[model samples]
Target: MHDQPPIPGRRGFIRQVAGTALLGTGLAACTSTASHGDNNDNTGPLRFAHGVASGDPLTDRIILWTRVTPGQDNGGGDIAVRWQLATDAAMRSVVASGTLTTSAHQDYTVKVDAAGLLPGHVYHYQFETGVAKSPVGRTKTLPRMDVRQVKLAVFSCSNYPFGFFNVYADAALQGDLDAALHLGDYIYEYESTGYGAEQGKQLDRVSEPRDVLLRLEDYRRRYAQYRSDPDLQAVHAAMPFIAVWDDHEIADDTWRDGSLDHKTSAYGPFKLRKLAAATAYHEWMPIRTPDPAAIDRIYRSFDFGSIVSLHMLDTRVIGRDQQLMMSSYFDANKQFDEARYRSDLYSPRRQMMGAEQMAWLDRQVEQSTARWQMLGQQVLMARMEYPKAVVLGECSSTAYVAAKRRAALDPASVTDQERRWLASPSLPCYLDSWDGYQSERERLFAIMERHRKNMVVLAGDTHNAWASDLFDANGRQVGVEFATPGVTSPGMEGGQPQRNPDDVAAMMTDMIAPLYYAQTSKRGYLVVTATHEQVRCDFRFVDTVQQHQYTAAVERSLRTLAGPGNRKLEECPPV
Candidate 1:
């Protein structure tokens, strides 16, 4: 069983702090100077190290979170912390105030639901223990009515060792955002010598613990190390977050039963490790648990008045079955087993979001009266079909690009082999995404088409920016997807180092029917702005993450109109 902290009941507004009501008149930008209490004097035993954050914001309630570090003199026992919510940056016009206790069981992390707040209003919050005070955090409640527009900053795949979180820093400066959506891989479980170790060595941002995270303490330490970064702290302080876990939060390519990265004989039972990871995630993250008994059941929905209904889905840990590997479809004669591959690819038993969650999603969409139904989830949901020759490694991206150019310039210059390769059947490139579970994807599309509602999907985990039109098996467009690039993780450029990244992106867009835009090289996030008429997505890319100082620019802006039979992406000028 998972060890969880006691959840406090929602309390009414208490008496305001004296002599600070005037602070609400003039508000400033939300920024945090707290860095693991490094800049503060060591006078008190308790200190706010990880800074303050708020998440899971509702119209009248929001989850406020912070961690307190106890000094050696203060024995490892429970410590009382006080939190206050106000209508000002200085936290002077205090609205709600409460006290909570934290112990080592929860890694000294405190989470409280600040209730009794006005809807569609920006609020400031802070945590205090003795003389130590956490940096003030700014948060907004979800709009209840009269909603015109809602803007969100979407991000994912932030590998600390890869580089600086310049994307987060840039997004933090955007004061107009309503909230931030983190589509997981929030923290990696790799050891210091694993994955991005070489980059860490060069950038001096190595992973903590120096070993793979298998226990609760390891995950806790890793979360602390990530929270200490100034860029991440600033973003958290700037606005509330709605987050869900992806594979790297526990292990790579994780499914319902096990993960490809884990070995049962060497790592022991995968369940115990998963529990530890989940427990640490709940303790550290600001998200509220829909079911305290079930830590993995994070599929939930948020309503932004009558304008947008955001349904965050758990497509990673809860219901995903083992991914289909291409290696299993090869025969001893070195020929591909097309018959068996097709049979298993369309297996009805294969599940992506599981039956229970799928049913719940159906109910949510059916009941929602909002103009836009947005699905915020992990992994690509669109069909990323590639030529069979490319899937089988018979033709490299460079070779395909060269062949296409030659064929375009002079038809007689194209070889017969090149022609055959170009005419090969198209197949799903990544089996781990919705492409692997075709039946389930069709079921979801059917649900959207049945409802006849405007749909938009926000996706991540590819570490690359993409915009694709979502279509069903019957060739009917159901919705559109806007996938954000990684905050720091490398994309396709990292894999195809020899080929030009522009060529790879151009070839992908040219070949893929649904793909409208593709940025295979860059680290950044996506700003999605939704109005009543249309939803626009601005793909912002940072020039580099290798250094603390960098420049950011909007690479592309795409939008889709609202209404039935209009679910297609069109390029828009960058804002």
Candidate 2:
């Protein structure tokens, strides 16, 4: 198991007093400050070290978050904090105010749901204690009705060690967004030399833990490190966020009970590691939960009035079964084999969102009165099957050969459904996505059809931009999906080495049943603008994540009408 760095002890009384005094004085003297929206108030650090954030907006309320880093005076103990919500940038017209306490037990983080605010109107919020003050954060409540437009800045998979979070900074400065939707991998849990260590070495942005996270403290330290990033802080401070965790928030390729990254032999029980990871997530993120004990209940819905309803899901840790390895179906001769497609792989019991959550989703869809139903979840729901040439090309790689060697030794372990796709132009089910649980995807499709849901899916985890027409196996259109590119993490080109990324993307679009557009080489975030007339999706891309600064350009812009009718995507010229 990985070890955590020791926490510093409390400072001396005199030193603490001096430090606090200097901090307060310096913050007052500073010219670069956070104002209501107009004034430039001193914004650096006085009390809040991680800055202020807001999330999980509703028609009447919004959750505000901040971390109070206490010094020797408080002995890192609980401190009474005051929070205020106002409608003006100057914070003179206060609408709501409250007092709360936060301590090390909850990681000194403060999260207060400011209720009674009008929907679709912008609000400014801040936290204060003694002479210390937090940077004001801007947030907006969800619209209940008469919502003309809502712009969401979508992001995912921000590996700190990989590169700069230029996408986050860009989105923060854009200022036109109503909210931000983070589709997981907000932080990667790997050692300095693991995952993107090579890039980290080049960028001088290494993981602070310096070891792979396993224990509770390890996870906490990792989140602390990620929150320390200025760009991430800026984005959080800029707008309200709706987030869901993918595998990296816990471990790589995480399922309901286990993960590929877990090693019971070295890391002990998988449950404990999962607990630690989930605990840290709850502590650090600004999300609200009905049952704090039920870490799996991250699946929930947000209604944006009569315009749209966003359903966020816990696809990684909720009810997902272990993934089926494709190499298991390959024969010893390195050729595709059809005999291994097992029946259990298609078993109705196998689920992406467990039975309970599935039922909940169905009810949410049925109950929604919104014009558009948006599924916000991790992993691509669109089908991606490989051609025989692509499969052979991928299989011929050294990595695939090694994987095949491992699978051949455990042929009995291969799932039947996976084996079904092992033949000519096999569908190499991306074990981590909806493709791996065909029955569940089908069931979800049926549920949506039953509800007559006019839907569009917003997905991440692919680290690539995609415009796909989602359909049932029988070739009936269900919805259109827009999979956003990464905030910093690599994409398909960065993962598969056998074929050129552009060539592979072209082949995928040409071969896949409903795929319309695929750009797997760029690194950036997405901007989704929603209105009653249409939902506009802008696949924004940056020149590079490797650099400290880069320009953002829209790689593609598409839209779909909002109605009970067809949800097919139509390409629109860039704005």
Candidate 3:
């Protein structure tokens, strides 16, 4: 069934590229901090409260951020903050220095885009106001055009109350990452006591607002509570971050208009609540904005030298239509029919990236000059299927069995029915991912093929590690995908109530054609290395998140060619 729906009307974006260019030129020209006098002194109370961070990196520019409070308490009101970026740690060779005033409107947080630094070079930055100074943060710009390699640390799903952010500290201690990528769920919207009672009590950590986040102040305080974590701060202090929002950043299962957790009936208006979340996110995080008015347009592209182009996407908000619910597919008997079940599933009208962003993505890929293109977005783009045997073995719930049957996956003991159920391949494992929007997934593959771009997709949110081959609808290989495990959020093994997690992952890997690797139980981040030759991804898992002190190991490593014909993938022996 081929369905080609008309593209939706494009929402206008207020591009700030020209204005930012002029500001960058001015910032780059300010090469000394001598004129600032005693402003750089640091022998007083803590004014720079939240420490320092940098993000949204470019070849010649990067954004710097810090929060300033007047007193040691959770203070309010406005204060002047001074920021300086230097080529070295000594603050002797200052490249850019500026002063900005922060008020309660922005929650006393400050963000500055420091430009004119040399590419592929390490730099030091700090924020100061009065006698208070922030901890010095290390940051770097994107590599030059001829650079050889880049190493990135990717993390996601950091639930503060769930456990200690040991994974963040672990990645920071690695000490060799050029930059970090946050694939969303940076802050969950759940209340402290109910969601993570045991861990929160053990860690003595509680979320702000004391309830589920809905108001602007509620979201702001939640971010503040999370930023107060020492381990999270250390990770931010260690390197620049490229971040994008997922469903939890606003609320669970968020789309363009509403969310699962937040409803217009309860939250007053979806737009207001969403704007509050987005506003708080921008205020706390050090991200560059092309236009302040158009906050939802976060689909941007960055170049990591000539080796790779990083395309960051906003899949949860701004674009996605409402997700297809499983309840809608069930029949009167809770039974299944293949043709009727898949009709709505493959609807051409179901949009994922939306119309405008999809067109924008096509242009970005088509005009790219880099050797390899990498998509940093939330949700898995690979095909995952749960075999009938595994389902029957692991799940005993009648409701689950009914749902499977409703999806046309009959597991009757009859030979033909069982055989067909087991042999029917590539069923949707998780509807929350790209599987839910199969037509859009196929459309992206068509775009990649039309542009002749060899791409790699980096995804997180399932809290599991995965390696899969991306294929077009015609079964032609398009690219590869590496999905990182969550930083602290529980995974399939420990989080869910299931039996034989390892067996399920192994079964999927064996039965699924596209999937080469799968680890359902482990919790860790991904270390990605890109070069002219190939891109290598290492899945590093830690021993535990329940404790602050834990050990880590690379569970698996996989690599794919940069410029490819057949696009062969190689898995190395884990050390």
lDDT against the true structure, per candidate, is: 0.83, 0.75, 0.74
- The sequence of per-residue lDDT tens digits that candidate 2 reaches over residues 375-471 is 8999888886544433445332223323334456787765553343333354534657787788999998998889887888999886667888888
- Candidate number that wins on TM-score, 2 or 3: 3
Please report the candidate that would top lDDT against the real structure: 1
| Model 1 whole-model lDDT (C-alpha atoms) | 0.83
Q: Model 3 off-target regions past 4 Å?
A: 1-46, 72-76, 387-418, 495-501, 573-575
Model 3, range 104-179, lDDT digits (tens) per residue? 7887889998888788888999988877789999999988788888899999888776677878877777678989
Report lDDT (Cα) of residue 309, candidate 2: 89
Which 10-residue span in candidate 2 carries the lowest summed lDDT? 16-25
Q: Which candidate is the best by TM-score?
A: 1
Off by over 4 Å in 1: 1-44, 401-416, 573-575
* Candidate 2 structure lDDT: 0.75
Residue-level lDDT tens digits of model 1 in 1-575: 21111111100000000000000111222232222212222255789878889999999999999999876656777889999999999887999999989988898999999999999999999999888899999999999869999999999999889988888888898989999999999999999999899998888788887999999998988898888888898999999999999999999888997887898898889999999999999998999999999999999999998889999999989999998876677788757777788889889889999999999999999999999999999988998776677666687645766787788899899999999987888776477788888898988888888989899999998787889999898788889999988899877664446656666667777667798888767888999999988999988877778876676777577899988768799977544
Compute the lDDT of residue 259 as modeled in candidate 1: 87
